[model samples]
Target: MQMNEEKDSPAARTVAALVARARAAQQVAEGYDQQRVDELVAAAGWAIMEPARNRALAELAVADTGIGNVDDKVRKNHRKTLGLLRDLQGARSVGVIHEDADKGITEIARPVGVVCAVTPSTNPAATPANKIINALKGSNAVIVAPSPKGWSTCAQLIAHIHAQFDRIGAPRDLVQCLPAPVDKASTHELMRQCDLVVATGSQANVRAAYTCGTPAFGVGAGNVASIVDETADAELAAERIVLSKTFDNATSCSSENSLVAVASAAEPLLAALCARGAWLLGAARKAELAQLMWPEGRLSPAVIGQSATRIAEKMAAREGAGRPEWQAIATARPSMLIVEEDDFGEDHPYSGEKLSPVIALYRVADFAQAADTVRQLYAYQGAGHSVGLHSARPERALALGLRLPVSRVILNQPHCIATGGSFDNGLPFSLSMGCGTWGGNNFSDNLNYRHYLNVTRVSQPIPEQVPSEREIFGSFFDKYGTA
Candidate 1:
């Protein structure tokens, strides 16, 4: 379709053409050796051009999007690539891939044909790379629909992938992205024709994917809330919170949206946080920060990545009625903290997820109350897809894990970093996490390579020889009841 075409003007026809190409490519893939999939992935990793690809993605992401910084996006892309490669190496996904000698049957790996994958703007390059690599591992072809805010960067990313495929003599159609912006109509058409749908973005996109009647893997919203009990080390907890909230300016879904601290530990934690550059806002100052985050009750784009000084200046100029007493203190990083009593329910606006470095603090009477407060926050944005805890008490940690509705509970570490990348968590490292029961997902983990593949159980009937009554009785009596 022409770039200038309206949403209703032949967008579906274009999508149909792309889907036809994808189906043709899938037929070709079915005949080619499955081992080629693995070879191509490995070659992409080892290719000298991989580093250049990384650099290109970083540059294009910052230049085209004008959202995040280049250096950090580079780090995110590199780490995600290295981590995905390490995790999927030697994993098998091929025809007749598993056999059971006793069952006299084999389980084969089948491709899902074509996947319509949607990605978000927060981590454009990382998310597409992840989806492409996983689809390759599972022998599925993918067509990406990136958010408009991220399309230019995503286009650059696709170009890089095509270059890699050409270098390896692989099918160019194995991975493809929508050449134009996808509106509701185009997205609906793509979803209906695709074999599977994988969406990671706004609620509207996820809902649309589910409504399309195709098998889907999706992630919902995350307003991650963390608990820090009295048993926790104040300094350590503060450090972890700082690291998580400041990481990528708190763009990650797993970043702590609020902190629930025990009343006894709250003061000490606040002290420790101040020592570590976290500015604790008093009632008036807290209100000012809130207004800065939500100017006239809406998110302010200007404040998203600006430094503390810039934010403070903007706030002061807007309020323009006083001495602007709240100058940007060195202790005040971009993130904000407010100490509030624990009776506030999910209706409290502070419980909502703020993508920028804004955090809410709640003081609970005890550990139980802290968990309860966290539950309230989760109810505001159920499951968060993840939660976090900081406590020396093993029982308390386990208690929170059992009681919280989130799929993943990060412990003793920064919620953002640990939830997505923890080796011990057994969750594939990704920016998007699928909220299970609480978040309405069938699975309580991030969608990854394994999710792209399905498992088949091969069962066999035992020989039809019937055991004699005496033998049966003897075996039962010998194993259980004494004869």
Candidate 2:
């Protein structure tokens, strides 16, 4: 397919094309009404089409990229879609999102014309679907720029969306994807042209979006870490860690990069993890695992998202250790384990986020040390995101919440699952989470349907009534102060 040359130029013509489309859609979209938009979105066969979408995305992803498993990708797609829809159902995006009778004012929702969304390889289908749904919710037209690794899956998703739009008689151009690789030039052009850009993926893309001078909502890198102290349930904590680390092969940004355990509970936690199919490697074994993870001092794509057995076999073969006992290796589960003393801090080769099933373990002298260790980890990838703690101490949990730069703090739960979902946390469910201050965004968003749309305030001046000080004091102060 021939890419648009208008996307090549950083001139007013490029901006005009996007603006014209938005202007045209705005007139038609506004006439359709919010209820109509909601009805179309709800009955668009999207929910029913979710399963097929997942399968298609997985098939195309594996065929094109040779990365990630079909089954895992399927699970990711389903879970993300379900969560995204659930969060969007009751959101008051159209009529009155907020109303204040006291001030005689209402904040009516208005669409921000055209939204340009950039998706990542880690989550192509879910991201595009999320943006499309959100833009529709607020009656905004959207254009997508899928990453090179995400092209096939994104194209399939876009096709499905177009099919839905066709069935509903919605405008075809309401949701469009750039029919080309999202190189720096094209992306920069798109960013400059669109009314707003919601970017979720690489830091490079985010920086470009920001530099384009358009309103941009972008996320940063994640190196999330968790802590389990003696006050916590070692068994349950261990199990949660394993589940989170291995969930979708740890592609989630909230997946624990390191587990800092107090020395008092370290042995018991390790044993508990072993009972739950985790293979705890000793000092020398940990070194071997690290080599496999960072071969030639870089992450190996082959090892990423592979089973523990596969990683162990590859490492054993590379070491020429004569196929280190299949039974021992099978029982040994090397992908997730404790690292040696050599790899501890920012200098540690594996301290950052690992997309595969691997975690670094650290033994702290005390609860203070555990908290300190967590602080150091957050320093590597600061707040505006989240932190997980497995302590029963309400005080410690609260303390961490206050101390950490992060916005959301998950307690005694699987960080990966809870971080971006609505099951427990009140936050909206999303695949792309904004890492607030530490991650350098205004809020830590799960990139729900609402994030894709912008709100415009419509205000009508109301006559002001001055209240006497006595009345104001009587209404509030007397109810509490005098009582």
**TM-score for each prediction?**
0.87, 0.86
Q: Tell me how candidate 1 scores on lDDT.
A: 0.74
lDDT by residue for model 2 (1-483), tens: 234655445544544565577568766776666577786566432732467766877878767765556787787667666666677776777766887766767777777778888888767776777777777777778888888878877887778777777777777677777756557666677788788898887778887877788998888777787888888899889888988887766766777878888888888988888788777666667666666777676667777656666666676677543345534775565545545342344457667677777677878888788777777776765446777889888788788877877767788898888887856667677767787767777557677666655555666677878898777788688667855
Cα lDDT tens digits for candidate 1, 92-161: 7776678877657778777888989888877778888888788878777888888777887777777777
Can you tell me which runs of candidate 1 are displaced by over 4 Å? 1-9, 32-34, 43-49, 101-105, 295-310, 321-323, 330-347, 423-425, 463-483
Task: Give the per-residue Cα lDDT of candidate 1 at 50.
Answer: 67
lDDT at 463, model 2 = 84
Q: How close is candidate 1 to the true structure, as a TM-score?
A: 0.87
